[model samples]
Target: MSPDQFHDRMWEILQDINKNEFHAVAAKPPTDKAIANLATSTGIALPKDFLAFSQKTNALCIMAREELWPEAKLFDVGPAWTFHRGLVILGIEAEDLPEWANIQNAYESLVELYELTDVLPLLKIMGDGNHYWGVKQDGTFVEVFDGEATTLECSFIDTYATEIKELIQRQKDMCELITKRNKKQH
Candidate 1:
């Protein structure tokens, strides 16, 4: 089917998921089974609505497709974000999935982004690509040609692992300071 055809059906299914009749997760609005059945039935490799729906609801997730995948729309919930000019959904995955995690990419991206707000000393990206992969170049966004979730893993686990940790600790400390100060005033 054409991209337009893909998008049209996608829109309908997304409306359903958002409307509460369908969900992506068994426990929540976007039930996994519902999403999978729809996607498979539609003949689309993956559901386009997953990203659109996520963008609409600000749904945080760590989705795995053909391995570990974290699409761009899902990963945008980060500080110092570098979006591709027109590429809506860039895919990647992160390794270290915490053994047992739910909505793995969403949780990872949310915490990962928040952690970087103040703690990242800096990122020096030096790579050759049209997208964010390999080494992060100044104007590039983290991207993956295949297995999107793996890209997330590489960014955080390989190149930026150290920075990711520092950012988390920094956020924790900042929160503690704020809490302490707030308690004193009250």
Candidate 2:
């Protein structure tokens, strides 16, 4: 699935789950100039599709700010939210280092470990402690778990959509089970 199509489907699922009460918390998509600046500042030649995705809309920060999936403890939204703010928080182009020591340290480690010049971090698996979904310069999708990189089965955009749909279904199943158990108790 294309990035836009994936996002549209996710929104549909989220809306159905929340009874259309939840709204997007992300601001408009970042401008092309902003995306280019982010690439230059981070010293990574980001994938064109990734830039296209970012331009479509900010990553899912709404779920982070709000407890969209209260029962789904497996869904950690922190990384997704924070990663979207990477350029701002990391101060990639700043003359001096970022004031936040931890942020600076983590940024350096990521840049060095991944040699971000060759691979760009696309999305972080927030719920799964210290894992990331990234894209290589050659357009291959990679999963970084515990700092080890593994190539994904297919393109990042399509795989991301498929995984997200499955995850949502899992959460829905869990919710149904919870509801049935609660009804029985009553």
Candidate 3:
């Protein structure tokens, strides 16, 4: 079965088990093992090394000062599959760094690189760690002094099928570019 179908079925099963209250804290896919179990029971092969993304702590701070509190929105930036202001994250493989970097560069370039916003260097988050950055509510890039970094984390929390779909598309796009580049060199 298609992966979406597989996952939808799994959700349905969970819904059935939860008596349709899927939002209960104990019901959603809380851990990788739990998610894998659902996939397995539903006869869906888990995507290899699936990543769960969590938001950076610094970003959480900005989110806390909000007028609405924890009800922030995902940015609608180009290249983003989805946006969440509180704690945005995605899971990608270390082996996929080149493609990830290309996508990152594409995002930075699309934002006009340093002209429109300063792209802080990727940072290793410290303690309960994840990485994030703040755009001042006033439309300015959050400034970073030398040796400073934007934070990020790989903690798995909310998982979206769109992220999986978008990542698949990125590989397709990269391969097509590689083929075109290779043909030119040959």
Candidate 4:
């Protein structure tokens, strides 16, 4: 699917899951000049599809769980309302965005730390700081774990959609299990 189609589909999924409530924070789309500047500054030739995606939204952070489940321990490190399990797509630094959401920062740090020159960090799986989904100059998607990279056969957007679906399913299952246990206790 094209980048625009993927973006629309992702929003549809998120909106449906949240019941039309906004559970995500998305940065304003960056200009073409800004994208060009980023490419020049990073020295990594960003893929055309990725650039297209970025134009739609520079970055996105979704807080899938607005509240903690009953009888569940909250180990998340962020806001009180956040369950901390969601999706994050890294992009250019914006004034309103946190430092960690900057694609340039992530890319440079990973490259410097791991001595990697091929992979560019793009997507971050919330709750885990060690793993990332990135793309190569050749447009191959890769999963990076502990600084080691493994190529993924699927497209980046497809993988991203799958991750969102899995997260939603897990949340649903947890809610069901909790309800069942509560019923049994009563």
**Model-by-model lDDT, in order?**
0.29, 0.48, 0.28, 0.71
lDDT of 1 by residue, 73-96 (tens): 654443322221111112212132
Please say which candidate is ahead in lDDT: 2 or 3: 2
- Candidate 2 Cα misplacement greater than 4 A, ranges: 1-25, 61-68, 71-118, 180-186
Clashing pairs in 4: none
Residue pairs clashing in model 2 are none
TM-score of each candidate structure, all chains considered together: 0.22, 0.56, 0.22, 0.76
Best by TM-score: 4
> Compared with the true structure, what per-residue lDDT tens digits does model 4 show for residues 1-186?
677776776566565466432267778777667677777776777766677767777788765544534323566343322243667888775556576787877887787888776788888866566778988777778999889999998877677788777666656765675588689999
Q: lDDT tens digits, residues 55-122, model 2?
A: 55444432222332342345434324322211111122223332331222333556676554444555
Residue by residue across 115-170, what tens digits does model 3's lDDT show? 43333212111111222232222322332323233332321111222322333344
Please give the ranking of all candidate structures by TM-score, highest first, separated by commas.
4, 2, 3, 1
User: Root-mean-square deviation of each candidate, in angstroms?
Assistant: 18.0, 7.7, 19.4, 4.5
Reference-based TM-score, model 1: 0.22
The clash count of every prediction, one per candidate, is 33, 0, 8, 0
